[model samples]
Target: MTALTLAAAQTLSIAGDVPANIQRHLTFMRAAAEQGVQLLVFPELSLTGYEPALAAELAIAPEDAVLSPLREMARELRLTAVVGMPVRLAPEVGVLIGALVLGADGSLAVYTKQHLHPGEEAAFIAGQGGEALEWGDDRIALAVCADFSHSSHPRNAAESGANIYAACVLISEGGYAADTALLQAYAAEHRMIVLMANHGGPTGGWTCAGQSAIWDTNGLIAAASGIGEALVIAHREGGRWTGRQVEI
Candidate 1:
């Protein structure tokens, strides 16, 4: 089998500014591509700074043209990128926290958050999560912030043959320790490589604990970043894994 390279894109978002965030995302994508990354995951609500209060107004369809630039860039770089945004399936369906996957082939897939954090119900509704991404011999499951908190979520992913669990989150300083412990446990228990993409700075009134990281199946840290914009990468080859951190 060929080598697989994955990365977590930790970034700081400008509240309610999709254009600016898109530019930053492009920068991250370019950097990841330069490093030969195959799959890149961004932090939760990365395009809009986790601004629930403005989600209703900011919600867009999965096929919205606003994301064309990102899709084009992903295709050009031949790198799959999972980006966070507010999604509205229809006028009647409530807004959802979505992880939209822009495939290297120029295809798009949507994964909504199946679970909501406390107080999130005021602006978003739970959704049926999307299918796992199939890449050659690997299956990758997607999670958004609170979704990974539910033990059933990761368990089901593993049960379904997913080998990698990628979570996009806006974790604050207060919740960092407990959250990371849970992720590491999930990695060890499920024997699935775990990747976490966290905000690089403050967002939605929370002081984000950056330190985005990746762990091997044994729950050992492969790579991790500090409190800033960076790309935490994990590369697998010859049945072994190695990692590195790149500040951007």
Candidate 2:
């Protein structure tokens, strides 16, 4: 079986400061690369700090120079990065909260959130992307914050033949309890490894709970972070998953 080393990063993003956030991402990337992580995932809107009010203003195209460093890092470190950002749509279509995926071989792709939370509908436009990204023998699906709240999210991922369902979310400290329970159920029900990346600081008035985690297919927590900038690295080998954590 093919083995993959992945990292779920819990970080602090500067609200409305895309450059600063990207800088933090690079810091995390270098650390992950040192540990030979194959894939590193960040929290939702990590480039813009999940500020809906400023999403449109901060939205950027996939080719924007602001992400050039990440692309370079991906290629240099031979690591894939699933980074969250606000993607600017063409012409007048508005913007969507999205994930910009950078491949180890200089590939770039965008996956926007298919579902929006109630309050988000007014500020960010929903998008159409819920496909899995293939890495060797693994098919990994991506989810934004609210996508997990919808039943069809994980269902669609499993239907797509994904073995890993990863989410980039901004769960408030008080909301982590419920969200964690739901993710665990998804892992057990779908029989796929579950990975989550959460912010370590406040965003848009909510105190993000930085418990980034990985769960085995059986719904057992394999690795979990604490309430700060941290990294959870999980290795999948021979159909079993085990993990370790590093606080940064």
Candidate 3:
């Protein structure tokens, strides 16, 4: 395999605080860029936090004022980033769970989470969606939290020639271990690399698990973060991989 350095960032986003959240996430992106990482993945709903009720109240359009700093961060850092937030399709309309992709060149792509969990069905509209994207030499795929639980999500991406499945998850404290193991098994079975960034700290009415993780195609675990803000980096080459915990 060709050598590739991948990075995952665990971020803590306070509800309705867009600026602070962006700054926190950018801190990790800048650090990853300094370390020469090819890609940086952040937690789901890192931009606006995971408060669906608040999202309904403060939702911003895809072209809202909230994304200016993030766009600049991606270009300045020269690293691709995937960050999640709620997108208000229109002022009078409903919001959707969206993963916004920022390229090193300042281009953008949006992937809305199509699979909604039980109560979520009442809050957001499901995306008119499909599979993830193929970015440059990396065949990349994406999903929010619940989307990954379904076999079809990963299976479709792998079938479509995606080599890496990047997931932005908002994991509760209790479900961390089991979810991670299941995701690992999914990646190994599909023969694709898996990268997941999860929200941490107490936000809204819930506390999220902070075990951001990365697993290679060979069923080998690459890197994982503890319960806090962290940067995890890994490199793969010739079917062999190695990773270590490093400060950002």
For model 2, what is the error of residue 22's alpha carbon versus the real structure, in angstroms, after optimal superposition? 1.2
Q: For model 2, state the Cα shift of residue 124 in Å.
A: 0.6
Q: What is the TM-score of each candidate against the true structure?
A: 0.98, 0.96, 0.92
Predicted structure with the largest TM-score when compared to the true one: 1
Query: Candidate 2's C-alpha lDDT?
Result: 0.87
**Which pairs clash in the backbone of model 2?**
none
lDDT of 3 by residue, 81-136 (tens): 88888887668877888888887888888888878888987778887543466565
lDDT of 2 by residue, 52-117 (tens): 899878888888898999999899989999999888768578888999899999999888998898
Task: Kindly list the per-residue Cα lDDT of model 1 for residues 25-66, writing each as its tens digit.
Answer: 999999999999999999999999999999999999999999
Model 2 spans with C-alpha error above 4 angstroms: none
lDDT score at residue 192, model 1, on the 0-100 scale: 92
Global fold similarity of model 1 (TM-score): 0.98
Could you tell me which 10 consecutive residues in candidate 3 have the lowest summed lDDT? Answer: 128-137
lDDT at position 67, candidate 1: 99
